[model samples]
Each structure stands twice: as structure tokens, then as C-alpha cells.
Target chain A: MTTTLALLVDLAAIVLLIAGISMFRAPQRARLGNLVAALALTVAVVLVLRRHNVTGLPLVLTGVAAGTILGWIVAVRVTMIQIPAMIAFQHGAGGVAAFLIAFVELTRSAGALTPVTRFSGILGLAIGAATFSASMVASGKLAAKLRSAPVSLRFHNGWLWLCAAFIVGAGIALLLEPASGAPAYAAGIIIVAAAAGILFSIRVGGADMPVLISFLNATAGLAAAFCGVTLENRLLIAFGAVVAASGSVLTLVMCRAMNRDLLKVFAGFTPAAAPAGAAPEHHEPKSPGVPPEDPFLAAVDALKEAESVIIVPGYGMALAKAQFKVVELAGLLERQGKQVRFAIHPVAGRMPGHMHVLLAEADLDYEQIFDMADINGDFASTDAVLVVGACDVVNPAAMTVEGCPISGMPILLAHEAKRVIVCNLDSRPGYSGVENPLYESEKAVLLWGDASDSVSQLVTRVGGEA
Target chain B: MLDLAIMLAVLVCSFIIGYLLISRVPPLLHTPLMSMTNAVSAVTVIGALLLFAVETTGLEKALGVFALITATFNLVGGFTITDRMLRLFRSDEHHQ
Candidate 1:
């Protein structure tokens, strides 16, 4: 009877995991899926604990209660704009957990651990340590606590390889001589792995953060799976494998969207030169003497005459907290019998689908939002393109600039519209540091202000006219 | 050795299945997808709990407790955040 009950619980856990995976694939079912996953996970944990006949139930419950409270507070209090950072923190927490579990296991029975378990334990510790530290850096960058620019030491790549070699050597020594101060060796491995994580993440600039976060998440999952191996926990193996695979796929998808080589990203290579055909001199300033047009009046005029408008939102919009005002302007235009739609770049905001969340928060019609592939063909016939706090995604440099970091990457064809009105705080280059040629086009006018304030001004003027 | 092989097989198979499934998720749902995965990875708590169940030194027990705390934090935080984010995307039909 006991065996039967355990089997049933295991079956239920697998079913729940499968359900959670399937639900995540479809947006319409994601909410219910999260709930189901949470429930299923809770049940599984309880069953596992009961089957194991853990003695310290009170202690376990206390730890869980405290953690759940902390997690709940963070999840509930964090704004949509901070979701990326929150995810980073969660990944960090998971990493720390995996590392601790493996550390305890190794310390408890280093001599008894089979060679395979020892090897897997070392792998788990190294990965978990790296994920923890790297994710902390990612969280700090996303939260603006650290500079978003890439930070690198001299010969950082060499340092990374050296660190890897050191860990491998130490791991082998631990396996061969398990009794000779194993704890000290494990601690050394953790420290070196943490340094590697820092070195790896600090060299990546803010622009590539989404991919970095996903990649680190996959590493964390792999570490947990290794922990499962060390403990012979089937559920841990299943969950970890699923996350590792999903996270890696997401990383690849993000990299593909930007036309970036995954290997280059891992090697921390930044493209520093303009493409050969593009006018290198014209990169920064096409005409310094020509001040941008009176942005407010220009935007108002364009909206007045436009029959259709496409709004391109980027990280700047998120920084300015301007999605609501942007939606207001869209609604105003829609009321004027003009068709207004959002053109979403795959990597538009700090995280994937950031713009969609902001716009969705404002209760915009879902039909009005279109991804790059879905709406790229509509730009040519559009009456006006409103570039809202977006720079590199709509920059024409991607097309004409060769050898540029973002060259050949797909971008919204904002220049093809009858008129382009850009709303940004300044003419400074975007995260890639490549100057945007679209800003200098004859048909483009720059609106200078915080995105929210400028959009609010446009809404007032447009509403008055209506 | 046999158990290790079975575990490896499960890991590899589940990873492939996960990759195929997650690839189908629309870009619109990427954020929620990430958060959901975060929640699922919290399964490490099971390992921690099992560790504490067996006889262990004081240091091991302490480490197990710490692991339990962190894993639970990720599991609870990840799910709640995903659910909160997904709530924003629900259509008007569901809101009423």
C-alpha cells in the first residue's frame, strides 16, 4: 500500500509537470498553467517529504514559510518594468539553493560518494555558484544599480579559461583524494566559479541582457539536474531538465531575433566598427547645423493629417513610464478615425515582450499590437510612424551599415512611412553605440522630452483639435 | 551505475521535449514563460528535504535548511510573479 501511494504521487507529479509545460506554450492558458504548476509542485513536495519521513518537519515548514513570504512580497510588489530584474533574483536564489544542497551532500559523505556522484556534485556546485553570482550581476544591471555598459578586465577571456582549468583540476583532485580536505577544495571551487560568473556577465552590455539572463537560467537548471543526480531524485531531474531545455531555447530565439552569433555572445565580442559601405563620417551627425524641427508642433501636425500610424516602443519607453500616455495618444488617434497599431520588435524592451506587457497594462486592444514580421509590410503605406523612445530597433543603419554590430539584423521600416516622428530625450546613440540614421532622415523630426511628458503633450494637443 | 544511466536518459529526453514545447510559445508570452520555468526549477527543494530526512551532521542540517529556504523562495516567487504578469494579458472577455 505504501509503495502504491508513492507510485501514485510520482505519477501525479509527472502529470502536473507535463500540464505546466503544455500550458506555458500557449499564452491563453499561461495563467491557469501557473496556478496548476504551483499546486502540483506543492503537492509533490509534500508527498516527497512524507515518503522520506523527514524528522524536522517544523524546521522545514519554518523555512518554507519564510521563503514563501519573501517570494510573495517580491512577486506582488514588483512593477511590470522590474520583472526582468525580479526574474534574475529568482534565478539567483535557485542557484544558491542548488549549490547549498550539493555542498551539504558532498560534505556529508565525500569518501562514500561514488566517482559519478562526486563528478556530478562538482558540476552542480560550479554551475550553481556561477549562476548565483552572474544572476546577481544581471539583477543589479537590470535594476540600474550598476552601469549597463560592459565592464571587462584586461585579458578577461584568458582569465575565464584559467578559471575553468583551475576548477577542473581541483574537481579531479577532490575525486581522487576525497578525504584530503574536501571541504576546502569545494569552497575553492565555489569561489572560482563565482568569479567566473562575474567575469562572464560583467563583460556583456545591457543590450544583450535578455539572452544572458536566459542562458544563466539554463545553467542554473543544469546545476539543479546535477543535484538531482547526486541525490537520485527523479522529480528534480525532470524539472531541471525541462527548465534547462526551455531556457536554452529561449536564449537561442532571442539571439536569432537579433541576428547575433551565440558563440560571439559567449566570447563577449562586441562589434566596434561601422559597416564598410555606410558613410563612417555621417554616422554620428548628418547635418550638425540643422536643428531638429519643432518636435511638438511637428508631431501634432503629423497626427492631424495621418490616416494611419504605427507606434514603435523600446526600452526608453519603459524607462520613462510612458506606456499609458502612449496608449492615450493611440486611442485619441483611433477616435479620429485613424488606424493606430503597435509594431513590436522581438527585443524591443529590456526583456522579451516588455512592450506588450506595458501596452497590455493600459488595456489596449490585443488586435492593435503586431510583431515585427506581422506588421513590417504595413509601414510603407502608413501615413505616419511614431517612434517612441525606440532607437536601434528602427535605425536604418542596420540596412546600410556594414560590419556594424547590428547590421543585417531586422528592424522596423519606420523610414518607409510618409513621415517619421521620433520621441526621445536626446540624439545620443542607443545601447549599441551606433548612431541611428533614421533620426536624420528628411521626413523625420525629433521630439525632445521624457517620453511620457511628450506623449501627454501630444495627447492634449490632439484632443483639443478633435 | 544503472540508476545514473536512467537519470541521464530522463534528463536528456525531458530536455528535448521541453525545448520543442517552449519553442512554440509566442514572443508575446516570453516573460511569463521565463518566470514559469523559474518556478519549475525550484524542484531542488525536494532534494534538500530528502537530505534533512536522513541522518546528518549539524552542518549538513543547517545547509539543508538554507537550501530549503532558497528553493522555496524561487518556487513561490516565480509562480506568483508569472501569474501576476499573465493577469495583465487576459482579454476583456475574461475581465468582466
Candidate 2:
């Protein structure tokens, strides 16, 4: 094929891919968009095969076959809450591919590459290696295989700087060293960069995981782009660039939603202020002026009487595996001819938009869910707010408390509703360690137990009432 | 030099277009969006394939296969899973 034709084909594939992503703005169009993007990739791959003089066809087929089988098995079986971990693991795999390709190209070239390509190869090596390691850590945490709290060392920022200095120094060394010395320096860069990746990710904890995962998504794409530059492949370069951009947008969106800057998240800025796992078991043990009433019965009575209701869910709901019951209860309420909508905080899940996907898996009507911004105003007018397995997101203290850990963090105005019912594991302060004042309010009823059981009860009670 | 310029242009232009296109995607589809883009990043498989275009040393061949397998795994897994996730949204359109 002619060079102009190849470039044109590359552009065509990229345009198709962009079209696929653009369709994601609508829920109904996204599935078709995904297929279009896959077709674009298939076309790109076929073009590469036709244009290049590829050898060892059987070997290549073996690798592709193995990968496809493994991927198919995992993809078919993995559940919704595991999506973050699974995506992180895949990013690690991409990282491995990127770094290995970069390393092989650098070592095999023997100085044949141009200066820019050579620099790109070194960059790909560093980023790919780091992304691999960091993604592993992130995947482990998301999967609950590793501790979710930020693990900070003494002088953690200083260690990060050292990691940076070493990566830069090694990059220069690879550029300057004799071609014979390339392997040793490349290995050094990989090792240090991997360490840097771990260090960079380990300081981000719990709720901050969405940002860490998104950032790793960007680095993984960046590594691929650099690998493309070294190989001088337009298709690869364009695809990688677009993925990198998408990841960057998600990362920033996650950062902004949480009211945090990217630096403080990755920098371990306030480890002492909120030791992640150190949340108090319960917020307010005393009911200052109490009615001797059962919270569950009160919740049932409240739900039965309310004409309009909103449900707020947090990560704890996912942990309790209560999504099905939660959705079931929503259906019951809807069938009762009540106005029911779900309010989802952007930071509610382990990753961005996770709660929506989790609830979607339970087959809830997509129209019933609303973003926090879109539904925060509705809380005041709603007759009842049901908070399931959540704490911080519904905490009225975020808006009212001065200089508190969660102060200024956007929360669902669940507190604004005429009545509030909390179904949680306990009266615990959430990950933020801030005492929620919602539990003490006169309108609030607390049902402390496993979320699935509590939600199922609500489903049963709501159904019986109907 | 011309080749380098073309490659750079592709990267920059694609990035800006991607940013413009993806920024409009609702948070409802963000997970699938990430999954699909991640699959796109697996395009490093091209670089992996190039390694086999020429005769390779034993070490090089091993690394080449490793890269190929992981890249393809990322690609297949990412796209298939994204398709599944996106279907959730599509199927919901029929519901009340």
C-alpha cells in the first residue's frame, strides 16, 4: 500500500473510533458505538498485517488465541462491583505490552532509530513499567485483596521526588550511553519507574481510588502512545492519544466531583486528618430528645405515607451486595404509584459512574436515576429520603460544619427531605471520619444491619403496604 | 523529520478530538467509556506484531509473544466487557 493510502486508512479508523466514543453521550447509542470502535480496531489490525511483512504466523496466532480465551472467560463471568478491579488489571496488561514492545525495539534497533523515536522508546519504557506496577496496586485495592487505606512512608513526598529524579537520570543515561549499554540502563529505568508507580498510587486511599484508577488509565494510554511513536505507527499513535485524552477527562471529572485537586489526592496531603479505616463505629449514640420507637417500623410508616421519595446509595450498599434488593424496593415503591427516584453522588462508588452500572445490572429503569447535581434540589420537595448503606454523602454536616474533614464536599440533600431513613451497617462515620449530624435529626430513622436484609425488609414492607 | 511531524500531528489532533467527543459523554456511561478507551490503548499490539515481522533473537521472541498476549487480552477483555456494560443501558430503554 502507498504511504498516503496508509495514512488515509489510519485516519478513517480513527474517525470511526471517535464516532463510536461520541455516541456514548446517549445510553441507547453506546452499545452500537462500542461495536463500531471494535470494527475500527479490527480494520486497523488487518491493515497492519497486510502492510507489514509479518513472519511466524503460527506463533502470533497462538498468542492471540490464548489471550482471547482468557479474556472471554473473565469478561463473561465478572460482576459489576468487580468492574474497577478488572479494568485496572487490564490496564496493567496494556502496560506490560507497551513496555515490552518499547524495550525490545530499543534493544534490537542498535541505534537505527531517529533521535525523537529513540527518546520516545525510553519514555514508553518508563511509563509502561510504572503504569503496570501502579495498576497492580490499584487493582488489588479495588478488589479488596490489598488494604484500601493510603500507606504513607516517612518523607513520602521526598521519596516520590527521588523516584522522579532517578527516572529522569536513567532516561538521559539511555540516550547518552553506548548502544551496548542500552539494556542495563533500560532495565534500571524500568525498575525505578515501577517503584515510582507504586509510590505514586499507594498514598491515595479509599474514596480517592476513582482518581487513582483514572490516572493509571491515562498513563497506560500514554505508554501506548509512546510505543507508537517509537514504532512510527500512525494508527497506534492516534488510538493511544485518544484513550489518553479520555482517561484524562475522567480523572479530572473525578477530581472535581470530590472537591479535591489531583495533587492532594496523589500527594497524601492529609493522612493524619482522616486515617481512612479509623472511622468511628457510630456517629451519635444518644437520641437527645427521643421517641421510644422502632426505627424500622417508623421507616416503614414513613415510606407508606410519603407521596414522593428519593433513594441515595453509597459504596457501602455495593459492599452489602444490596443492589438487587434496593432496586426491588424501588420497583415496589413505583408500583405503589409513588414518585421514586434514585440520587447518586458522583463519588458514591469505587469508580466513576459505578453505582449507575451496579444498579443497571439489577435492571432498574435508567430514567429513575439522577446525578447528585440534577437531584439535589428535589430532596427538599420529596416527602421522604431513603439512604441505604451510606453515611457521608447524606450527612448534613458537610454543608453546615466549619473546618470539618467533609465540610464543603457536595452531599445529597437527603437531610432536606421531610423524613429520612438510614439503612446502614451501623451508625458509623463514613470514610471521611466526619460525624454525620443527620442521624440525630427528628425526621431521621436509623435501621442498623446488613443492607441486603434491610433493603429486602423494605421491599417486603413496601410490597405488603401496596 | 517529516515522518516525525506527521506522527506528532496525529497524536495531538486525535487527543483534542477525543477530548471534545468524550467530554460530552454522560457520567452514566463513564465506566463503559473507560473500558472502551482502555481497549483502544491496547493498540500497542501493533508494536508487538512488528517485533515478529523480522527474525528475532530468542529473548526478543519471548518478549514479543508476552507483549502480544497481554495486549490482545486487554483488547478482547476490554471491548467484550464494555459491550456487555453498554447493553445494560440499551436494554433498559424498553423498561418503564
Candidate 3:
């Protein structure tokens, strides 16, 4: 195949991949379509390459096909809660691809290298390889395929600095003899980098995985792009660029969610643990004033009085897989001649659009879901807020608590509703792992059950009354 | 070699972008979104490990080893955290 054509095919694949990722926040059908678009684009590119006679290993091709198929199935069958694992797997694949391509090029031209090229190659190879390893470990951790623990060795910073110094020294030595013994020196750097990455990750609490994983993903993509640069391949460069950009964006988002500086988190650091004897003792939310009403009963009342109702959901809703039940209850309420709209916080579920995916599963119309900013104003005018499994995001604590784990983080204002009906089993802190104050607010009521069952039962109860 | 450096830059940039994007999503999407990305990065294991056997330059071999090690740690650590987080969903076990 002509170089231009191959480049075009590769570019198309990259574009499709980006589009698919972007649409992940859209409805399931839309997400599925986007994913299919990416797969089709990839297949088209592969076919074009094949026609041009750019051959790939049978194993690579097979793996791609298998991955695509499996991804499609998961995309269709799995809930949004499962989407993070899938994304992690894809990042790993992209990282591996970049690492391998670089390796192939390096081995094929091992004996011949200018000082600069050798230096760049070693740097690229080390970073790419390190990123790949880190990404894989992160994937396992996020997917629940591995355990998450803070691996803290004594004087970790000192060891890390020592390793860094060693790598720099090795790197300089390689520069002196670029063509002959540089790779051996480069190997030492890679080992140190890997150790540093592991050690750094181990010190962070599990809550920070989202941000850490995203940063690692970006590293993997950058590694691949570096390989492309060494090989002077434009397509790899472009694709790698896209991956890196997307990962960076994700990392930024995670950082914002946690309200932390990206650099601080990456510097092998951890926040001071809740000081000994300082963490507020866990206490049952002393329901203030009148007890909060049952979400089901509240829904029935809302159906009876309101012309428009907006349902707000958070991570709690996703955990319960209550989207279908939410739909059922919504339908029953609509049948009572009231309008029902779902208010989805941007980061509402577990990944992105967790509520949207769940609602989509229940087969609701895409138009019915409302963005938080778009729907927040309507809460006061509405009759109820049927909160499910969510705690931290919907809890007013983010804005109310000064030094809480989730302080200053943006949250859904479920507390703003005239009647707040929470379908939670009990009080528990959220991703930031802090207690929720919303439960004690004057307007809130804890429905007390599995979100799915509660919503379904509410549907039945409301239907019977109707 | 030069190409490799550029690719590395791209990877780092994309990761930063990914992090930024996560900030905007609601809490519901945080976990699943993370898990999905975890899966994507997990693929690095296969990609990095294969390079070990590919008779690359000594530098390439070292890079491959580094990739494998990091990938192993990230994948394992990520899953463990995920499982722990998921325990929140078992509403029956926790609250009275």
C-alpha cells in the first residue's frame, strides 16, 4: 500500500476511536453506534492496509478482532458501572501496541543508531514500557481483578531520588556511547522508573485511582507516540497524540473531582491521613425535625400534585441498577398525568453518564434526561427528589463541610427539593469516603432499601394506588 | 527513536486530557469511567511483554521490561481498589 493511503487509514482509525470515547457519555444506543463506528473504521483501515500489502502478525490481527467483538458485547450487555474496566482495558491495549511497535523498530535496527536517535529511542522505550506496565497494573486494580493497597516502603522518597539519579547517570553514559552499550544503561533507567511508579501508586489511597490511572494512560499513549517519532511514522504519531490528549483530559477531570493538583498527586505523595482521633466518629444521621418521607409515598404525592417532576440520580442510583425501576416508576407517574424528567449530574454514576446508561437500560427516551445545570433551577418548583444510592455527590456536605474529604467538590443539590426521598439502605460516605450531611438535613428522608427493589416496589405501590 | 519520543509525549498529553475530562462528570460515572480506562491501560501488559521476546535493541528490551512491571502493578492495584469500592453496592450487608 502507498504510504499516504496507510497513513489515511490509520488516521481514520484514530479519529473513530476518539469519537467513540467522546460519545461514551451519550445514551447507550448512541455510545454503541459510536463504538461500532470506531470498530468499522478500524476494520476499514486494516482492510486498506491489507490491500496495500502492509501485513500484521496473525496474532495481532486475531487479538484485535477478538477484542473488538468482546468490547462490542460488553458495550451492549454491561451496565455503565462496568464501563470503567472496559476503558482501562482499551488503554492497556493502546499502550501495549505502542510499546511493541517501538521494540520491533529498535530490534530491527539495533546495531545502527546515531547518538541522538539512540538517546530518543531509549527514552521513548523506557517511558513507553514503564507506562505500559503501570497501566496494566492500574487496569487490574480498577477492574477488581487485583487488589489495591498502598505500598509504602520506608524512606520511599529517598529511594526514588536515588533511582532517578541512577537513571540520569545511565542516560548520560548511553549518550556517550549511543550505538554500542546504551541500551544496557537504558535498562537500568527503565527498572528504576517502574519501581518508582509502583511505589508512588502504592502510597495513594484507593480513592485516587481514577486520577492515577488516567495519568498512566496518558503516559502509555505518549510512549507510543515517542516510538512513532523514533520510527518517523506520522500515523503512529497522530494516533498517539490523540490517545495522549484524551487521557490527559480524563486525568484533569479526575483531579477536579478530587479537587487536587495533578502535579502534587503524581509526585509520589499522599495527603495526611485523617489525623489519629481526629476523624469524626461515625454516627447515624439524627433525622432532624420531621422524619424524611418514603420515596415511594413522596412519588405518589408528587404524581398527584405536580405537573412536572425531575428525578435526580447519583452514584447511588448506578450501584442499585435502578435505571429500569426508575423508568418503571417514571412511567407509572407519567400515567398519572405528570411529566417526569431525569436530572443527571455530569459525573452522576460511576464512570461518566452512569445514570444515563442505567436509564437507557430501562429503555427510557433519551430526551427525558436533564443535565444538572439545566435542571437545578427546576428542583424548587418540583415536588420531590428521589435520590437512590448516591451519597457524596448529592450530599450538601461538599459545600457545607469545611474540611471534609469532599469539601469544595461540586455536588448535586438533592437537598434543594421540597421533599427529598432517598432510597438508600443506610448512611455511608461516598468515593471520597466521607459521611454525608444531607441525610440529616431538615428536608431529607431515607427510604431505606436496595435502590432497584425500592424503586420497583415504589412503582408497584404507586400503580396500585393509581 | 525520534518517533518514539513523540509518541511518549502524545501518551502523556492524552492522559492529562483524560484526567481533566473526569472532573466534569457526575459522581455516578466516576467508578465505571475509571474502570473502563483501567481496561484500556491493562492492554499494555500484552503489548509490553511481547516486545521482550522481539529481539529489540538493548534499550528496547529494557523499556519492554519496564512496561511489563508498571503494567503489572497498575492492573493489579486498579482491580483491587475497584472491588473494594464495589462493596458499597451491597446495601443489604451494611446499613440497618
Candidate 1 segments exceeding 4 Å error: A1-11, A269-293, B93-96
Question: For model 3, how does the per-residue alpha-carbon lDDT over A1-466 read when each residue is reduced to its tens digit?
Answer: 3356665665565555555455445333233433343353335334434443322245334444454454444444544456555555555545555545554545456565555555656566667656656656665765667765545688878887886787678767766755566445655666776666566556654456667666766676566556656655444444455546656776776677556778656554443354367535443434535653554565466556657666777655666677778888888788888878877765444344446556655667656777666777787777777777766668687887787656777766767777777777666566565666666766665676688887787787778877
lDDT value, residue A305 of candidate 3:
66
| Clashing residue pairs found in predicted model 1 | A275-A402
Candidates 1 and 2, the one with greater DockQ: 2
lDDT of 2 by residue, A330-356 (tens): 888877889999998878888888888
Give the per-residue lDDT digits (tens) of candidate 3, residues B1-96.
444454455455544554444444444334434444443344344444344333455555554555444444444443443333333232222235
Top-scoring candidate (TM-score): 2
Instruction: Give the runs in model 3 whose Cα sits over 4 Å from its true position.
Output: A1-80, A111-120, A145-175, A179-191, A202-210, A264-281, A284-288, A292-307, B1-96
**Higher-scoring candidate on TM-score, 1 or 3:** 1
Query: What is the C-alpha lDDT profile of model 1 across A415-446, one tens digit per residue?
Result: 89999888886777777778787776778877
Question: What fraction of native interface contacts does model 1 preserve?
Answer: 0.77
* Superposition error at A102 for model 3 (Å): 2.8
Candidate 1 lDDT at A16 equals 85
